[model samples]
Target: MSKTRNPNLDVIRCLAVLLVIVIHFFLNTKFYDVTINSWQLEIMVGMRTICMICVPLFMCLTGYLMHEKELSWEFYHKLWPTLSVYLQSSALIYLARIGIFRERLSLADGVLGIFSYSTAPYAWYVEMYIGLYLLIPFLNMIWQGCQTRGQHQLLVATFVILCILPTFLNIFGKMIPDYWVTLYPLAYYFSGAYIHTYETEVTQIPLRLVTLMIVLLSVMHNLNASAGRIFQWLPMNDFGSSEIYALTIVIFVGILKARLPKTIGDIAKYIAPYTFAMYLVSYIGDQLIYPIFMNWFKTESAMLAWMAVPILLIFIGSLLLAIAQKLFWQLLRVCLDKFWQKYQVL
Candidate 1:
């Protein structure tokens, strides 16, 4: 709402965004988690834990900026822009896929998978984002209708409870036909929507400090137990221990908002903006760029390529997608103007 960005929020977004990239980054190199080699293990564990916050934080940002007391036609009016981006991204993805897969892929797979992101190349997040955009007005109803903090917390708790149940019964993982995104991501979406709609800044006082301690404990929990898969109790997945993840995120944001514009804060914001583009082009990096180069390291030639290649690939790929998105947004704006002219109100 202000002309200036909140360096604090931006920093959080940036770090959360890059954690998503770090997932693939670790996958591409010598990040296997054998005990004697634990530096990469730390990276792998940290990344896995951090990524739990990414989408939730994004939706919280969405709810923070866009929520309103009443569902408006204006929400419906934004549809063309969101749809246009989604469609353009899908098209770009298809082209990228064709380039990558070339002759080995079939026309039918292309036709179906173009819109289906789990099947498509790294496009699942974008698809879920578009899906969330379509649901905003309904979520707006929930956010706006909750008249008290208690009510808001109740609703969010209900959402988390439903999302977590299947895991206990093996329902979320197996009995539930579509486990990963559909039921599970709702906890993130619901908690984010509720918090943004209800709370201001981060929690204050002893609660805030206690939350930070809890976050550290949770991170260490994962770090110490990732090899055993016991720490998989953390809700990075649909059936993740969402209570811990949500609490951890809440705590981190408090510290984040307070100390920004420093090195960590700036990078946290700067790196996140390109996460969408990075996802779009990550396979390109992983398969084509990083693997061929970064994986060649044997410690004799230096581990330099491991870091350099992933960063370079992410930067170049994100730059091109950013340009495309800018142009696409401009086109969407023109479309909006035309629609406004026809409707007399926008």
Candidate 2:
């Protein structure tokens, strides 16, 4: 099948990357002295809950685009570059941390550390993404076999029960199978396929309703965090604590319906390809750059700096890196093609 690029999807990816950066800022920032009712605390909780939509939206897009594609050498070929970035970024982060902190790095530590993003926790998405890629073919089979919308909906409903419902119940102290967590991405994969196949119109009303759900869920999360003792009857917070799935679908559909100027779509197409690169760069920023800012700025001053400076710096840096990566990949492709031609001539 030929590849077609959707400007709207690109816009979604670009937005997801930005959301990811802000979420990382919230996660790494220190709000220790801030009270539960403090503005900083509220902002942090809101950002995290809202930004949880990022990964799921990414997965949905992936499924929508690639679920039907055959898993061949081309599949791994496309994936290898992303894996390379993860490995190289992890190594660089490990080396930088050990060097700066004057920690000893043994051979086992060095080699193993390069593959594991121990110091750079945000790269956990890479591992999850690889798992999702492996399951795509199987997921495609399921998608293909479903002859009717009802059949697919039944499967999705079952997934919601087995994978999603348990997490909600767990918040209430009900224990479910631990294995259900592995199936969460599958639910999202199916969701993306459903959206694409059915071409459902997620109009303004549904978007507003989903937005309200996200707000309510975020507030519930903050209340639980601040007053867990009082809300002891609430389920244990797990994968289901937020409206991530709902918000992701809403955001994805909203983007699809949005009518933008040709100039904006053109810009989105240009920027969309670099979002993964931006994500990698931002992961490095979270590990290396943010800490320096955290220490430099003190107290509420730090929160303000976090809200302003770090985000801009990370964004600017990621944009440059993404552009550079595009150039680098282009050069590499040219070199490889030339080499293949020379060998064929020989």
Candidate 3:
């Protein structure tokens, strides 16, 4: 049997996901809803600024749980379920878009759609994550030899290189870096896995100092982006980033560490399995649900409704996706077992 993994990590992951959902729901609703309200617009921008840290935090978590044991074709077997989830959701979404959006489709589009990285728009992170997972054996092999202290040092050094290198290349804009040149987001996973395997504890440091550093870095990062400058001083600009951004992720991890666990076996089991599913479903909601909600509420910007509406939708959407994924997995497992049972008897 596999060893029991970190319990707190799950809760932290759940929170990070929620933050992403919360930020997206609010940001999209504010920006795209039928009519824009001033207050809601400002709040959306503000929340967008705060929520920007979600992905970075996610990267940090991925690093924290470094199960760098071995690499095999078998390691990829876990992705099959996730792969199934992606396929099913894509089919459902494509059908819905065709039916509701009145968007035209062709056989070529369907072919391209299948190779989609994640859900539809968020596919980049999804496909890339599986890619990184596949490489874990090699990365772990390199990491395992280093002492704990060495691993931590490597992470810091890697962070600096990943963060700055992109900026230098990007100095010339689209012509220089292009698509393939970007790898910072991928670096986050490496950073996270490195920490989990090597970095001993976040608790040893004082919380205030940690908080200050996170805030400072995140601010500088965002300011650079808003200024239309050449270099984005933060982590992972393509997926959305700011300089102080990674710092915020670290700070949030510290906060997560301080909080008590809010979930047990069942609740944990319920939310944990669906995290990716929810990630996929949220995109659907972003494209479809928010549009309808925007049309319905007709809320003015700068109003509390702007903030409240998206948060509610995100929570509901994520919760529903989590539940649906669990049931789907449960049914699939049962059916598979039955098939084997029949085969054995035959």
Candidate 4:
């Protein structure tokens, strides 16, 4: 049986989607074009570091929520909803590209773009998710097969060494072979599983300490960015560093342990289901919103001053679009069912 929805997990989902929008802000604005000499720019880099966990949060949430999954036809069938949403969202985005953006494309190319995820660029997450979804049952098998907490710890530790550690070590000078670091999702997945398996032990750490850890990490990220600017050899930021893994874990735990008000929890639960659709459809909002902001604000720094409004607009617009697509899909399903019933009677 499926587990009951956890409000805290839902809140994490909402936060993850919002951070998705936050990370994309760098791409939509002139964040990279300007020099990072100023403190404001350095702080922006820190925010980017924190937001980098957006994808990892989703992956870890998958492990936390679906740790009991096993290989079965019914289990595999769960993918249909995700696939359906993606295909429909892709079609809508394709139409927007042609109609709104006035991008020229032949019929075959349009269809190809939809299937290939080229039409909605952000749907690359969909491509990654499909592979991860297929592997979840097997991953759970490994999680379940562990006979003891120590064994579970060993398994998670091994994944960290192989997948997470290399990303951090290689940043300096390829200290370790990183052939398996691309498999970092498994490391995060197993970490989430470990947390869920030992919630009592994991949550025992004080929330204040958790917040402190995140703050210190954020500062480290800022310092790292500054050093990169000074040295020219170090990177300005590493996308999936060990720092992100540490932050993702502590944040997930802190939120899980907090006593959020019911109203806030309700809002989170409502928004959770739409996050996947929101993430996929946000590219539409970005395309529509960013140009207007660019026209209004002469400088990138000036635009940063009014960042919250555009982010809010994009979030709201994407949420509405996702809801509309979901309603349209449901209506079509109902119509097709009725037509089939009528044909069967005849």
Best by lDDT: 4
Better of 1 and 2 by lDDT: 2
Error of 1 at 335 (Å): 15
lDDT of each: 0.58, 0.69, 0.60, 0.82
lDDT of 3 by residue, 194-225 (tens): 55543456455567776666555544444444
By TM-score, the better pick of 1 and 3 is: 3
lDDT of each residue in 1-346, candidate 1, tens digit only:
7577666666656555555566566556554433423455555555456555655666556655556635678766776755454455556556666777563556677667756763346777767777777777787777778898888788767765566544434434555322543455556666656555545533443466666565666567567656543224433332245434455356444644475547866665555555555456556555666656554665512543356556566656755675666577688889998998989864
For model 4, how does the per-residue alpha-carbon lDDT over 1-346 read when each residue is reduced to its tens digit?
9968679999999999999998888778877666666666666776777787788899888888888888999989999999988888888888888889998977788789877889778987888888988999999899999989999999998988887778667767878767877788888889889999999999998777766777676667566656445412122234345777878888888889888999999999998999999998999999998889888875646766888888899889989999999999899999999999999999
TM-score of each: 0.70, 0.81, 0.75, 0.93
Give the range of the ten consecutive residues with the poorest summed lDDT in model 4: 230-239
Give model 4's TM-score versus the native structure: 0.93
Runs of candidate 1 exceeding 4 Å displacement: 1-7, 29-39, 69-73, 100-103, 106-111, 118-120, 164-182, 206-212, 228-240, 262-275, 298-305, 324-346
Worst 10 residues of 1 by lDDT: 230-239
**Model 2 spans with C-alpha error above 4 angstroms:** 1-4, 32-35, 88-110, 117-121, 175-179, 201-205, 227-242, 301-306, 325-346
Please provide, for model 2 over 162-208, each residue's C-alpha lDDT reduced to its tens digit, 9 standing for 90 to 100.
76666555665666664675577777788788778777543434576
